[model samples]
Target: MTPIRPLPSYLVQRFHGWRATTYQENRAWYRRLAESGQHPRAMVISCCDSRVHVTSIFGADEGEFFIHRNIANLVPPYNPDGGYHGTSAAVEYAVTSLGVAHIVVLGHSSCGGVKGCHDMCRGLAPELDEKTSFVGRWMDILRPGFQKVAHLPDGEILRALEMQAVLTSLENLLTFPFVRTAVEADRLTLHGLWSDTGEGLLETYDPARGLFHPV
Candidate 1:
């Protein structure tokens, strides 16, 4: 097989600098983690958005959170059909293997994936309507969510859809028997969260109120 090219010099140099400084400064902690292995208490399912920094927002340290990122942080309902399912595999491992106590579905404001789904559903983005589009298929998980908010005013639709993404993920997570069992047995808890990139605010979903409240 042909060998792949190395990373850019600047990135390599930056990594070396981090290894010499941050790694050196936290050598003992890193060593401990390496020896003990990770046993993170929570699993965070978040969007693959550069602006949404899970660690920075929660001030989480290494090995503190088991994170899974996807286009829209959407969780597909459990389907045991012997197919390739990355998200389901991660959730299974987190629940059965790691025994994570919490599973948090985190969405954020100004999500390109959410916007794309909105556009595609509105017939505004014909490109995403193609069967060959991976993003479109992934965003299909959030279509039910879109239907719920489609009646809202155009201006208020985006934010509502963002929160819906979180809620939808939380709802889908329960489709996994492991997740449902853990939740019912009080071994695990499910949470939904949304972040406002512009306002630098976090909001949490309240199942009782069926609404998101500022955190």
Candidate 2:
């Protein structure tokens, strides 16, 4: 195997500085966390977009949340076909092992994944339409969502699809037997959120109203 290159000097220096300060300020807290293991109350599934700061938005501390990130924060329907399912594996671990009380699906404005789905559905992005495209296959999970908003005008499609992504994930979560069992037993709850990155606004999905409202 090829030897991996060393990390950049600036990042290494920054890491050292952060380690020193953080350990100095919270050594006992860090030690306690290591000893106790994680018992987070919530699990957050969100986009891999660097602009979406899950920790910063929630002001979460170490071990406060179990977070999983993917291209568009999508969750596939439950399929126990013995296939390789990274997202499903994470959900299983979170629901069965972690025993988390809540699962939050967070979608954001101007998501490239959502835009790609829109473009592909509209025949604008042929590359994403290819069968070998991993992103295309992954985004296929949101095809149903795109269909629901396909009748809307071009200007309104992206935002609708973004919210749809959150709703889709929430719906898929229920397909998992463990998740459904926990929810039915009143042990777990589900939440959906959409963020307007440009405006720094957060909106939550209201299942009763079937809409997203600003928080």
* Candidate RMSDs in order: 1.3, 1.1
Error of 1 at 169 (Å): 0.5
lDDT of 1 at 53: 96
lDDT of 1 at 174: 95
Using Cα atoms with residue i matched to residue i, what is each candidate's TM-score against the true structure?
A: 0.97, 0.97
72-112 per-residue lDDT for model 2 (tens digits): 99999999999999999999999899999999999999999
Residues 1-215, candidate 1: write the lDDT tens digits: 76888899999999999999999999999999999999999999999999999999999999999999999899999999998899999999999999999999999999999999999999999989999999998999999999999999999999899999999899999999999999999999999999998899999999899899998
Q: In model 2, how large is the Cα lDDT of residue 123?
A: 92
Per-residue lDDT value at 130 in model 2: 98
lDDT agreement of model 1 with the native:
0.95
Candidate 1 stretches with Cα past 4 Å from truth are 1-3
- Runs of candidate 2 with Cα error greater than 4 angstroms are 1-3
